[model samples]
Target: MNNSKVFGSTLIIAGTTIGAGMLALPLASAGIGFTTSLIIMITLWALMAYTALLMIEVHQHADNSATLHTLAKQFLGKKGKWLASFAMMFLFYALCAAYIAGGGAQFAERIANFTGVEISGTNATLLFTLLVAGIVIIGTATVDKVNRVLFTIKVLMMAVVLTFLAPNVTESYLMSMPIEQGLVIAAIPVIFTSFGFHGSIPAIVNYLDGHTPSLRKAIVIGSAIPLIIYVFWQLVTLGVVNQATLIENQGLSALISTLATTVHQSNLGQTIGIFADLALLTSFLGVSLGLFEFLGDTMKQRGVSSSRLAVGLVTFLPPMGFALFYPQGFITALGYAAIALVVLAIFLPIMMVRKARAQSQLSHYQVAGGNLALAVTSGVGVLIVGAQLLITAGFLPALG
Candidate 1:
C-alpha cells in the first residue's frame, strides 16, 4: 500500500514535470550549447525545489481547504492575492497553449509519416484541441489509471532513446563555451517553463493534507526526479548530436528523428516518431485532466455543481484559440508564460513563507536557511524572471 502511494505520487510528479516544456528544452538549450545550459538547469532546479517547499509549507498555516487565494491573501494581502491569481491563471493557460501546439505538431508529423497524407499543423491543432476537450468532458475516473500506463510507456521509450543516444555523446559537447545572454532575463521564461514546477504547489499540498513536513519532503523529492531527467536529457542531446544540427533543427524531437533515421532505418525512425507523438499526447492529456480536477475542486469548495464541460473548456479554449489563431506565437508566449509561473511559484511562496513564520512557530522542515537570505534569494529570482518577460516581449535586447 505504501509503495502504491509512493508510485502514484512519483507518477504525478513526473507527469507534471514532463509537460509542454519537455518539448521545448531541446530548443532552448540549442542556442547556448549544452554545458552552460546544464549549470543553469541545476540552478533552476534548486530554486524550483526551494520555492515549491515554501509554497507547500505555507498551506500548513491554514486547512487543506486553503487555496492559493487564501494563502496569498494571508501572506501578501490584497495586491499579492490579485497578482498571484492572475499569474496562476496566465501560467496555466500559457502552459496549455504550449501543450496544445506541441501535441498538434506531434500528431501532424505522425500522421504524415504513417499515412503519407499530411495534416497541416493548423488542422491538427484544432482536431487535438477538440479531442482532448472531449476526453475531459467525459469525466473519467480512470484518467489516473490511464496516466500510469502512459507514464510507463513514456519512461520506457525515453529510456530506450537515451540508452542509444547517450553512449554516442562526447566530452566536447559538455565543455562548450557560454554565449552572450547565456543566462540573461530573456532565457528566464523558457528555463522556468521547462521545469514544470508550477502546478505541483496545490498538488503536493493537497496530497499531504497540508502537513507541512510531508509536503516539504514530497516537493523536494518530487522536484528532484525531473531535475535529474532534464539534466540527463540535456547531456544526452548535447553528446549525441553536433551543435550545428541541434541549432538548425530547433528541438530534440527533430534531432531524435534525424538520429533514428541515420542510426537505424526509416522504419525504426517512424517507430520512434510514433512514440514521441504518443508521449506528447498523453502528457497533454494528463495536464488537462489535472487542471480540470483543480477547477472542479474549486467549484465544489463553493458548493456549486461543477460542469465538467465548462471546466474542460476552461482548460481547452485559451490554448486552442492560441493554437488556431497564433500557432507561431506559441513559442514566444511560452517564454512569457514561464516567467509568469516563476511569479506564481517563487514570489508568492516566499511571501507565504514569511507570513507563515509570522503567524506561528516554525516546524522543523519549514526552517530552512536564515529568513534574510531566503528573502534575498526569492527577490532576486522574481526580478530575473520579470526581466526575462520584458526581454521576451521585446522591451529589452539580449545581452551582447
Candidate 2:
C-alpha cells in the first residue's frame, strides 16, 4: 500500500478501536487477571481478524454495491434486514451517545479538578456536540481529514501514558488467577464494546480496488492493527497499575491519575488527567464523524438526497439527551449495545458467508483452507461471548 493508503487504513483501524471501550479496558480486565485478559485479547484478536476476512467475502460475493443493511436483505430478506438495522442503529448511535456523555463527564471532572469552573456534563456535552456536529454536516472528506489529526493525537497520548506506566507493571499482576464466569459474563459486553472492527468493513471494501484479493488484504491488515494496539495497551496498563487501584478507579483516566500521584504526586497526576481528557475527546470526535457518515450513506442509498441534515441530528441529539438526563448510563448501556454490535459485526458476517456458500456465490479465497477452521473458531468464541451476554442480561442464569 502507498503511504497515504496505509495511513488511511491505519486511521480507520485506530479510529474504530479507540472509543469508550479504551477508557474502560482496565476495569473490564480487572476481574479477569491481567494474564487472562492478555489471553482473551489474543483470542479476540484472532476472532476479529477472521470475521473481518469473512466480511470481505461478503463484500466480494455480493452482486451489487451494498452495505450491511443490503447484505442482510440479500441473505435473510426483510426480517434479517430489520434486525441488522435495529442492531446497527442502536449499537452505533448508543456508542456515540456514550462517547459524548462519558467524554463530557470526564472533561467536566478534569476541568473542575484543575480550575474552579463548575462545569456540568450537560454543558460539556452541548459544547462538544456542537463542535462535532458542525464538522460532520460539512461532509466526508473533511471528516476524514479531521480524523487523521485526532487519531494521531489519540495514539500519541496513549503512547505517553504507556511509557510512564509500563515499567511499573508487576509479573504477579499479569499472572493472577482468572475470575469466575459471572465476572466474565458481565465483562463480555465491555470487551466487545472496546473492539470496533465490524463497523469499518464497508468503508474498507469501498476503498479497496473492489477486488476480492485486495479487499481481503485490506480488511485483514486493517483489523490486525487494532488488535495489536488493544493487546499492547492492556499489557502496559495492567503491568503498571496495582490491581486494587485498577478496580477502585473503574475508569482508565482515574487509574492513570492514581498512577501519576504515586509516581510524581499531584503534579504528574494533573498532567495525566489532561492527557486522558484529550485522548478521549479525540475518540469522541472520530466516532461522531463516523456516525454522521454512516447515517448519511444509509439515507443516500435509500435515495434520500437530503441526508446531510438527518446525519447531523443523528450525530448530535441522542448523546446530548443522555448527557442531560443520565450521564452514568452511558457506559453500562454501551456495554450491552456492544454485544448487539458484535453480533452484527462478527456473527452476521459469518452468516453472510454461509448464505453465500449455500447460494454457491462464495469464492475460493473466502472459503479458503483454514478459513473454515477460523470460522468455526469464531463461532465458538461467539457462543461463549453470547451466552455470557445473555446470562449477564438475566436471560439466563450464571453457568452452574
Best by lDDT: 1
Q: Residue 71 of model 2: what lDDT?
A: 85
lDDT digits (tens) for residues 1-400 of candidate 1 = 2445555665567667765566566666666777667777788788777777676667767767777777788778899877876787677677677767667777777778668988888888888788777776776666666666776777777777777667777788666654556434455568667776556566556665566655555666777888888788777766666666666675435655766754543355665565566666776776677567767776787898757777776778778888777665545667767667767777777777876787786553565776875877677676767777577566755321
Off by over 4 Å in 2: 1-11, 63-65, 113-115, 265-267, 296-311, 361-363, 368-400
Cα-lDDT of candidate 2? 0.68
lDDT values, one for every candidate? 0.69, 0.68
lDDT of 1 at 347: 73
Inter-residue clash pairs, candidate 2: 169-239
Deviation in Å, model 1, residue 283 alpha carbon: 2.8
Error of 2 at 69 (Å): 2.4
- Output the lDDT of residue 395, model 1: 79
Single out the weakest 10-residue window by summed lDDT for candidate 2.
361-370
